[model samples]
Target chain A: MNISEIRVLIGDDSILARKQMKDILEEVGVKNIEEAANGQEVVEKFRSFKPDIVFLDIVMPVKDGTVAISDICAEFPDAEIIVISSVGTQSYLKQAILNGAKDFVQKPISSSKIEEILLSRFERS
Target chain B: MYTQLFGNYLLSKNIITPDQLVDAIRKRNDVFVQPNTIAMHFKLISATDAEYVTKIATDKDSDFISTAINLGYFTREAYDEVKDNTLPEYLFLGQSLINDGILSSSKLEEYIVEYQSNNEMIDLELYSDQKDNLDQLLLNLFIIANEELPLYIGKYINLLFTNLIQFIGEDFTPLNFLPCEEYPVSLCSYQRINGVHPLTMYLDLDEKVALEFASRYVGESFTEIDEYVKASLEDFLNLHNGIYNVNLSNESSIEMKLDPPVFIEDTSITPGEKEQLYMLPIVYPFGTINFLFEIEKQETTSLF
Candidate 1:
């Protein structure tokens, strides 16, 4: 998905992290943005709003990001999604990548890291 | 950590020798055994309660008296008497120096109360033959100093100091013994995560916050990890051991020694229950360094 053309949805359990991702997206020049608190919320918003990109937290109550990512991807194969987590175990990372997320971000949110990943992936795509 | 902060505050003014400071802390522990132990020896507190306090204090790295009172095992009178009666001069001296000209009689009274509230010393010998009070005091000093050192030195100095503490014994763990007020550090314990006989250290901190420390200067995260930080952390551990063993000098000398530090990359390791977790953030140059430690409990049979 084109970074500028990205209409993104942000979903995470932590209020701090969600806001941080939103601010980072704005900094990166993504204009259209929506927010959600959990995986199910992300799915509902994805179906209704049909954002071009989604930043999802892997560990959340009521259908985690992994489930949400699969649910969204199964329906919207072209949807751009990124999984975020604090416990960056290799398993979680691999699962996220396998579930059709474009990328992943670690928690205690680092702005530079997210920006770098987005720029590298989207710039190439 | 506050203890070391008090130490630096004192050292900057040249109030006490490093040796003297160590002596006071060591004596405090030996002089004031576990209040529960003392209480039990005198038949003041029940055997069950004493054993419970020993476990809580050791596992939590907290004061036996207060832990007992908090647990409702002892009355307020029992906790106060023991806490107030035993003041580690070395630990309090730093605070004394900070308020040297400023501390009034009433303020001194307050410091005494705070000292009672803040101080939490344990006797490891209750379980082991180790008698090196100095070494224990030094270890405590190092942990305390790492937390106490100013931001000018950077907060990572604490991690460096923890590296040094790993040397003090075969294994180490940080206990989350007490609740911290500000810039709380994360509790950490270093032991053979899984072994037959694992040694643990207890740490206390504020659990709500992450581990970050203030920088040397205001409005910055303390990032620099230099020799000063390394040496200071080392010294703090040394003093903690020294103080821990000092008071026992006359009765017996526990062999306290340390090994070299081995740095492990940043990875997540859960301390489990023996090493309770407490967290508090310290505002430094940049961010807070979470302070952490673990406490090893005394066997009920051993306490008796």
Candidate 2:
């Protein structure tokens, strides 16, 4: 349950977003990390990597984060998915939470917020 | 912004060359009067006192006002009064243009009157009513191509300038709008807004300008159009479009969603066959970056 032992997955259409999140996660002492470019990739990576935490963007090309969240949650009920999006409308947030996402962070995602989430997850684990 | 608008007007009329416009803009930044000059103008302090204050300020690496205060040359109230009474930006630009021989003082005055009258901003003072003046200028300057689209061009351009000032440096001048079917872009990032109305917004620049822009946005040095540069441009477009959508939603009760930003590298991008695309050129110290908005004519009821 140590921070470095926790596996992390970042699903974002923007390579910049994924890299930024990965850098912050690394800074926070998370060693094992994976990235996906779209919703389909998110699902595929989730099944293959079985990451402990997933950060999913709401908008993508092939599939979207909402469906990805639903599919992952339905299959892995214990999966901890955090919806990361640029759009933070009320309806989007509600739909994300409804689809069984553990939390939501609006983009330009801050490192402090990521650190806080990681710290809380560390404590809980 | 008004300076740029006026410069564009002059350019369109063939009264000033592009080089002149750029020169005037560069000179605009140098038009500020030093504290000694202001003090001399207002007779707030003697020339000797001003010189003494300037010497102390330089030696201490402090500002004229602070040095004057420490030297007991001027009170805080006097300093504030001098600062507030300085010339406005537009006037400074006009004076700079005149000094550069681009226009005579009388011609400058004539043009100012004409510009104000034509734009129906006669009451727009250069300094005191800036926010309102900008609102008026943007509303008057931006011409919406499609009749169906709301008068949101002003709002969009306002938000653009605000964000540019926030993220990028405020040292930029927005040029006149030009209509073109295709732009030879070295680097471009765009996002589509879908909902009650659909539109595509693009940020396009040359590779060198893109590098400088990306570096400015992320506070990092970028020498090439790499993944990080592309992502930074995409993120900027997304961030700006996100704010625009949120504003529209909050103010007009219109919900809109953004598609993930797409980056086009080393290619020319063309507007859709039926879409009306307008290119707004913004001149920065680094280079010119063009913003292209391709808005299709919606067949639905007018949202405005």
lDDT of 1: 0.46
TM-score of chain B of 2: 0.69
Candidate of highest lDDT: 2
lDDT of 2 by residue, B74-183 (tens): 78898677676745445655556666878754466567668767665634244235666666666545544334444666777888887886788766667766777787
- Candidate 1 lDDT, B1-304, residue by residue in tens: 3333344333333444544444343333233333454455334566555666677788999877777778876687755566545433332342333233433323333443443344332331121232233233433443344443222112123433333333321111222223323222233222111121122222222222112211121123334543333323322332333222222222232222222111222344445544433342222222223433322332111100
Report the error of model 2 at residue A44, Å: 1.5
The CAPRI-style docking tier of model 1 reads incorrect
Q: Where does candidate 1 stray beyond 4 Å?
A: A108-110, A121-125, B1-176, B179-304
Cα lDDT tens digits for candidate 2, A7-59: 99999988878888898888888899999999999999999999999988998
Give the best candidate by DockQ: 2
lDDT of 1 by residue, A1-125 (tens): 67777677888654545655788888887778888977889999999999866778776667877778889889998888977664344555666778888876654456787777678667522
